[model samples]
Target: MKNKFQAILLSYFLLLFSGSACDTPEPGPPDAGLYHNYAELTQELARLQAQFPELAKVVSLGKTVESRDIWAIKISDNVTANEDESEILFVGGHHAREWIAVDVPLLLARNLLENYASDARTKNYIDNGEIWIIPLLNPDGHQYSVTTNRLWRKNRRNNGDGTFGVDLNRNYGYQWGGPGSSGSTFSETYRGTAPFSELETQLIRDFAIEHQVAAMISYHNYSQLVLFPWGFTNAPAPDQTLLSQLATTMADSIFAVHRVRYTPEQSSDLYLASGDATDWLYGETRVPAFTIELRPRSSSPGFILPDRDIQPTFQENLPAALFLIQWSQQGGTMTLRLK
Candidate 1:
C-alpha cells in the first residue's frame, strides 16, 4: 500500500509540475495556408529572388533573438550594384500580431516585380530608383505569435524578469521613453532598458544611417490612417508642410482604390508614441517617413484580419506605395531643423 501510494504521489507531482502532462498542448503554429510563418516567408523571398534574379536581390540585415534572418529584398534594375539612385524603404511587421503589415509589403514587392514587364509605371519605378522592402522586422516575435501566442506584439527578448519581450516599435532611439511607451517589461509598449536596446531596432537604425533613404513607410494595421512624424511631441516637425502634403497624396491614392478612405494626420494626433520608426527615420535621417495603418478601420477584426481581405487591402494600398516610390525620385526639399 505504501509503495502504491508513493507511486501515485509521484504521478500526481508529475501531472502538477509538467505542463505537457496535464495542460493542453500549446497551440500549434497557425494555419500555414492562411498566413506565412518565418520559414514560409523565407522560402517565398528565395523564390522571388530566383524568379527575378536581375530585379530582386535578397540580403539578411541580421539575426533575431531566435536566430532567424531578418531578410531585406532590394528591387531595382541593377540589383547587384548600388547606383546614384534615390532609395525608398518599405518596412513591415514591427509588431508581431500585425500580420497584415507583413503581407502588404510582401505583396508590394511581388506586384512591383511581376508587373515590371507589363506595367510602364512599375518599370519606371524599378529602373530609376532603388526600392528596399523589409517585410518581417521582428521575426522572433512573429514566430512566437504564430506558434505560441497569437497576440504577441513585441520582440522575443528574455526580459530577465519572467517577461519575454520589448516592443521593437518603442525601442527606437528618437524621443524614447516618452509618452505612449512603458518602462515595465510586462507592458505591451515597453521601451527596452535603453534606446535601441533590442537588436531588431539597432539593425534598422544602422541600416537607415548607412543608406540615403529618400522616403520610408513603416506599415502597421487596423486604423486605416496615414501618419507623419513628431509622434513623440505635439510640436510640428520642421518639414511638417511637406510631410502633410505627401501623406495627403498617399491617402488620396488609397481612397481612389476600393473607395477606402485612410485618414492623413500627424502621428501624435492619434497617440503620443515615442521611439517609433516613423519619428526616428525622419528625425535622424531627414527621410520623409510615414506610418500607414492598414485596413479594417476599427477594432472589430483588429489584427486577425480575414485571409480574403488580404488581397483587397494590398490592392488599395498599392497605388499609395507606388506614389511614395515615385516621390522618392523627385528629391523633395527637407528642412534641416529637427522640430
Candidate 2:
C-alpha cells in the first residue's frame, strides 16, 4: 500500500506541478466520468498518508451521525515535534451540493506537498506552519449529493420530526438557536435539536481544541465571496482590525488574478448565520477564521462545474491562501480598503 501510494503521488506530482525529467504516463483517453466520490476521497486520503508517512497523518476526528468517519489530514514537515507553529486549517464540502469544494482542498493538499521542496513559499509555510486539510467534512451529505440528490446541503441526520438533516453551519455551539436559525426542520436552515448535537460538529470542535489552531479557512461555492467572523450577529470579533486586514489582503490577491468581485464582509452582511463555523472558531478559540466562497456565481448554478474551471479556480485561490500564511508568519493583520 505504501509503495503504491508513493507511485500514485509521484505520478500526480509529475503531471500537475513538475513536468521536467519526470516519467510522463501514457496519454489515455479522458473518461466521461464524474469527479471523485466519498469512497474515492477516503482512498486518496489513505494513499496520501502512506506516501508521506512522516509529513502526513490521517486522523479519525469523529464519526457522523450515520457513523461515517470524519477524516482529517495533517500536513507539516515535522509532525512528531512538539514545537508550536502557525497552523492553518482548510476545510471543504460543508455544503453537500458544492462538488468543487471537495476538490479544492484536495488540490491544496497536493499542491503544497508536491511543491514543498521546489516552491520557496510553499516550503516555508510547511516548515514553519502546519496546514491541516479536512477535505470532506460532511461525507454522508457529499455522498448523498453524488448518488441520490444534487441539492442536498445538510448532513444526513434525522431530527425526529420527519425532517432529514440539520444545517451543520447552524449546529455549532456558539449562539445556538439564535437568529438565522429556524425551528422548522422542513426548512433548509434547520438548526438541529441542539448545538453540537451532531457528532460531525463535535468532531470539529475536538480538533480545534486539540490543535489550538491559529487560523482557518473553510471552502464553499457559488457566492464568489470571502466572509469573516461575527456571523451569529453583526458585532465584530475582538480582533476585528486583524481579521479585516487579512480578509482584504486575501480578497485583493484573488481579484488580481481573475479580476472578479469578491466582497469580504462579516457573515451578518450576507445573512445572520448563528452558530456558524467562522463564529465558533473566532468566538471560542480567538483563532482568526474566514469562510471563502469559491467560483462561478451567476454563470453556473448547482454543483456541476466544468473540468476546465478546476485548474484556474485552484490557481486564483492559491495566492490568497499563501498570503494568509505569510500574514500569519509576519504577525500582520488582514487589510481592508475603505471606500
Candidate 3:
C-alpha cells in the first residue's frame, strides 16, 4: 500500500508539467478535491452552472427517497434552449461503493466545461452537441457508504417489509425481476418490488426517454471493461455486431492512453444482471448505450481506488467519450470495423 501510494505521488509530480495529450490538455493526478460527499457534489454542480451560465443548465430530474434532488447538468452552447442537438447522457455512481465511478464522469464534465474556451475540439462538441451529466445517481446510497459503511450500494429506502434499500441498478424496467436479481431485500442485488419502483431509477429512465438521448454511458468500477446489453442474459442484441465494434473501438482508445486493457464484452459475460440500466437504455431506445467498468480490477483497491487513479482513469476514457459524442451526432449510421 505504501509503495502504491508513493507511485501515485510520483505520477502526479510528472503530470504537473506535462503537455497536452492530443488536442486536449493532459490530465494530472487527482487531488483530495476529486472525491466528494453528497453535499459537496451538489455544491460542485451548482458551481459549474453558476460559472458557465450560458453553457450549463442545471435541472432537477426529481428527488431521491430522502428528498435529495436528483440533478442532471446539461452542457451545450445554448444551454437555455434545447435545440435539436444530438444529446448524450453520462451517469456515474450507480453503486455507491464505486467511488471512482462518481469521480470519472464528473471529471469528464469538468474537462469539457473548463476546456471549452481553449480546446477547439471540446468547444466544437459543446457548440454543436449536448452532454448531460448526472454525476451521482444514488446520493443517499453514496452518502450512506461514506458515512456508515464503505460498501453500501443501494438507495436508502425503507422497503416497507423490514428492509432498507433497493439496488437501483437492478430496478430498471427491461427484463426486470429475472436472473441476477433477488426478492430478498437484504441482498445487494435486490430488484425492488417492481421495475422502476425506486424513485432514483425512475427519474433516470424518465429523463433519458423525455430528452430522447442519443446515447448513454453508465459508469461503474473496479473492472477494466466496456460492456453493453443484453445485461439480463447471454443472448446478444440484434445490433450486437455494431455495438461490439464500437465498444472495441472505445476500449482500444482507453488502452492507447495508458495500456489499460479494457476488453469489450456483453455485460452477462462478467455477470448475469437483469433489470440493469445498460440493457434498458439500449433495449428500449435502440441507441448505443454502454457501461464502462474502470481501472484496477483487483481486490486490493476494489471500489476504493486511490485518488491518483482518478485522473488517469478520466484521461484514458475522455477520448472514448469524445468518440461517443461525435458518433451520436452522426445519427448512429457509421460503419463497423474490426480495428
Candidate 4:
C-alpha cells in the first residue's frame, strides 16, 4: 500500500508541474525566430551583391548609434556609375520594432535583382531607373528590440537623464516640434533637442540632398496605411491631389495582391506628426514622399508578425513598391509650393 501511494504522489506532482509549465505565457512571440537580426541583414545584403554584382552595389551611408553600418543597396544597370536616371528610394526600419518594414524592402531589393534577367518589367526598372533601398536604418534600436526588449521603438541614444532614446521619425527638420511629437525625453515620439539631431536622420537627410531622389517610401507598420506628406497639419499639401491619386493607386495595388485594404490618406489624417521623414523629404526637397505602414492591419499580431506572414507581406507590398519605382520614372509631378 505504501509503495503504491508513493508512486501515485510522484505521478500527481509530475502532472501538476507539466500543467503549470504549459499554462505559462511565452517570454516572447514564438515567431520572433522568423526575423533576421542586424548581422544577418548585413550578411544577406553581402550575399545579394555577390550574386548580382553587375546590377547591385551595397554601400554604407553611415553608422548607427551602436556603430552598426546603415547600409543601402543601389540596384540599377550601371550600379557603380552615377547615371542620370530617376532615383527611387525605399527606406525601412525607421522604428526599431517594425521588423517587417526591414524585411519588405530587403525582399523587394532581392526580388528586383533576382527577376531582372527574366521579368521584362523588372529589367526595365533596373535598366532605366536607380533604386536605393536602406533596409535597416535604426540598427541599434532594432538589435535591442530583437534581443532585449521587443517593444523598444527608438534609437539607443543616452539622453543624460537616465532616459535612453529619441524617436528617429520625429527628428527630421521640417515643421519639427509641432503637434504629435513630444519634447520630453521619456516620450515615445520624443523629438530630439533639435532637428536632424540623430546621426541616422542626418545621414539620410544628407543622402537625399546629395542624390536626385525623385520618389521616396519610408516603411513603418501595424496600420496598413499608405500615407502622403503634410504630416505636420491637417492642411492640404501643395501637391495633395497628385499625392492622393498616387497614394490611392499604390493602395489599390497592395489590395489587389492579398485583397487586404490599406487606407490611402494624408499623414496628418492619421495624426499630426511633425519632423517625420516623409514630410521632410517632401517639404525640403520637393520629392514625392510616402510612408507605407505594412502588415497586420490590426494590433493582434502587432510588431511580432509570424514567419508564415513574412513572404505574403512582402508579396503584397512588392507591387506597390514597383508602382512607386515606375512612378519615379515619370518625374513624380510635384506642384512645388510652400505648405
Which residue pairs come into collision in candidate 2?
A: 245-334, 245-335, 246-334, 246-335
lDDT of 2 at 211: 71
Lowest lDDT 10-mer window, candidate 4? Answer: 23-32
lDDT tens readout by residue for model 1, 124-229? 9899999999999999888888877888899989999889999999999998999999999889999999999988999888887677678899999979999999
Number of backbone-clashing residue pairs for each candidate, in the order shown: 0, 4, 0, 0
lDDT of 4 by residue, 1-339 (tens): 999999999999998787558653334432346677888899899999999999999999987767889999999998999999988899999899999999999999999999999999999999999999999899989888887678889999999998999999999999999999999999999999999999999988888878858889999998899999899999999888889999999999999998999999999998889999999999987778999998888898888788788899899899999998887887664544433
lDDT of 3: 0.86
lDDT of each model, Cα atoms only? 0.90, 0.80, 0.86, 0.90
- Stretches off by above 4 angstroms in model 2 are 1-34, 80-82, 299-302, 332-339
What candidate 1 gets wrong by more than 4 Å, as runs, is 1-27, 30-32, 333-339
* Worst 10 contiguous positions by lDDT, candidate 1: 330-339
Model 2 RMSD, rounded to 1 decimal:
13.4
> In model 4, which runs have C-alpha deviations exceeding 4 angstroms?
1-32, 335-339
Error of 3 at 267 (Å): 0.7
For 76-112, candidate 2 gives per-residue lDDT tens digits of 8876565588667888888887878888888888888
Candidate 3, 97-159: lDDT as tens digits: 788888888888889999999999899999998899998899878877777677778888898
Clashing residue pairs, backbone N/CA/C < 3 A, model 3: none
How large an RMSD does model 1 have? 3.8
